[model samples]
Target: MKALRKIAAQAGVALEEVPEPSAPQGTDVIVEVEAAGICGSDLHVDDWTPGYEFMVPLLPLTLGHEFAGRIVAVGPDVEHVKVGDRVTVMPSAPCNACPACRAGDSEKCQNKQTLGLRRDGGFAPRVTARASGCLPLPDAVDYELAALTEPLGVGATAVRVGGVGQGDRVVVLGPGTIGQALAIFARLSGATDVAVVGFDDAPRLETCRALGFDQVYDLKEPGAMDRLKSDFGGCDVVFEATGKAVSITDGLALLRMEGVFVMAGIHEEDARFPATDFVRRRLQIRASHGARGPEWRRVLAAMAKEPEIFRKMITHRLPLDEAVRGFGLAHERGASKVMILPGQG
Candidate 1:
């Protein structure tokens, strides 16, 4: 089987022939990956960025985390899921020996192993996944939309963290897939005004507009910041989804007094903001990482209900062989939500 793998600690991923997964072991199941999405983190890893150095020991691993497919085989202990079931796998796996896991609160597992990051994951025709992390997908949710469940769950979780409600004004910094997800869920959460901003991100900003976000801004354009300030200044909530350190201060500027600011991106550098301004405004900063069980359910239900809306996020599709090219496109911000169909070839 050919797989996209991070072969070393240095930059770049390679398309290499690797052995197919063996028979299921313990609670694992064999998933024939139909669709997988290239994420920003994948770009970071491909670029050998700073934050993902933890993956150094896990080099030469298959690279893909957000994916959906049908189960081909299952271990004897896998009772909840079975063969031929369509499902999406949650990439984060908890070590059973961890204290949090022993207490049955796996969500707080201090030593969690992420698929595609800490171990081999779905970027091939088939991959092995734990049955516990598999969520059954509704028949209406096709493989393409199902592949989006993870990132969508991430966005839904951020919206929940921000406590966005009816009539609230929301600003999302960065018009990438995660930023798009933030904008979508904010509207779903009943926020009347939602703005998505991007810096030199024309393609993605246009994507935000196509998704029905009228208030889209390109910080590179003249007076774009002034216009954004006029429309969304002192907004009820502001979300930093750019992963850029400067977005913290930029997003804080749009927040109202006592408004919540959610950090939904994985930053590679420390962010410094004005302490006096933040304190005087009574601002609150909250961090939202991967989604929990509740967010997964909400995102899955939403995707099933309106597959087309979510489908719009996918701008490019490629087979496993062209995955490197797909990564390039995503890295250049020329595409949003590139879906890698491993089964296509």
Candidate 2:
């Protein structure tokens, strides 16, 4: 099988031939990769300058977490699914008996492991993951869209954590892949005045416009905050997807009294923001990590009902061999959802 793997002591990945994996000794299954979505997580994988990226895989690591593939084989203990079933791989493989999992918040599972982060991932012709982390996809969903099921779950989790609803005026900061996914999910969650604020005055704003945001701002100009304040008598909910400190501060200021503020960005360092602002406004600060396995199913169901609008969000699709081009495009604000077709396209 051909797999994209990062060799030991390097910061790059190459497509190479590798042996197929069989069912794990534990209750795990091996799936043949169909489509894998490159994500913000991949950037962290490529960041070699970092203070340990938490859990860098033992070298020759395959890349990808957000993927959908066919279950080729399953271990004897696997009960929920079997061979021939299509499943969207959940990015995080939680330790089921941990405190977080016992508390019904598996996203924060203590001994959690991830598919792409530590072990081989779906950026291969075939990959293996714990069967419990697999979210079964509907027969009607296309492989490209099925690959997006994980991101859509992040959006669903954000809305739940952010408390967005019918009358809420929401301001979403950043226009990256996750931010755009956040916007679509916010709209579906019944937010009426949905706005997107992007750092650059360029193609991302265009994508925000096309995504049908109620208002789109090229925040590069001065007086951007004043305009954001004018839109709502201060916004009701702010989803901060930009990792920058300024974006976080701006998102905090945009909140209406008693409004919810959701932080979804993975910032590299601590951000300084007005602590008094939350106190003065009586705001609710909630941080949303991406969703767990069942949440992925909700996202898939949402995608199934709204294919026309949801599918259009995929702006680029490339073969796994063109990984660099795909990664560059997805990292840029210019591209929307980008996916890698692992096999025949």
Candidate 3:
């Protein structure tokens, strides 16, 4: 099979011929990947960003976690799903015996192996995953959209953690894939004013505007923050999705007193924020990582209800062989959601 493999610890990936994966013993399932997404994290991995050193030990990894496919084979112990089922796998597989997993907080499991990062991922035509991680896709969701469930789950989890509810005002910094997902899910969670901020030239911002966001602000514009405050008073919840140090400070400034601030982006470097301001405002800070717990089901249900709107986030699709080009588009902010059709040449 042809897979996009990271043959080195550098800034690129190569499409190489490799052995097709099979369902090994112990509840594993082999999936024929239909579509996979190029995520921001993948860009960081390709760039060998600081703090991503853990990936160095897992070098030559197949880089893809946001993917959906059809099951072609399943191990003997697999019961929840069967061959021929269309599904999306949760990339993080928690060790059931860990204290966090035992406490039902698998997201914080002490031992978790993430697919596509710690193991072979869907950047290939076929990949093996633990059957327990696979979630059945509804008929309303197709392969391309199901591939997005993982990132959308991140957004859903952030909203849940931030306690966003009916009539709440929300601001999402960064209009990338995860940022756009946050805005959409915030609206579905009953937020009346959901605004997204990004650079004026970012292509993803155009998608945010087309999706009918209540407000889309370019941070570069004069008095953008003042205009945002004038229109919405202050945000009830501010989600920092840019992963940049500057965005962290700006997001905190936009929050209303006692508002919740959700850090949903992965920052490779250290970031600083005002501790005095946090205390003065009595603001709550919550960090949202990979999707886990009930977010998978919630996001899937939300996507099922608004498939077309969710689908609009997909702006580019490429063959598996064009994986490098796809990553370039994503890294350059030229594409909102770039899908790699692994089965295609």
Writing each residue's lDDT as its tens digit, candidate 3 over 1-345 gives 788877787777888888877546779999999999998888888787776677777878888999999999999888899999999988888878889999998778877888988899999999999998999999999999999999999998888888899999999989998999899889888999898898664577889987778588887888987887777555799999988888888888888899888998888678898999989999888999888747888878877888898888999999998898898888777689999998777
lDDT score for candidate 2 against the true structure:
0.78
Clashing pairs in 3: none
lDDT (0-100) at residue 108 of candidate 1?
95
Any idea how many clashes model 3 has?
0
Clash count per candidate: 0, 0, 0
- TM-score for each of the candidates: 0.98, 0.91, 0.95
- How far out, in Å, is residue 113 in model 2? 1.4
What is the C-alpha local distance difference test score of each model?
0.92, 0.78, 0.87
Superposed model 1: Cα runs more than 4 Å off: none
Candidate 2 deviant stretches above 4 angstroms:
8-10, 23-26, 49-52, 96-107
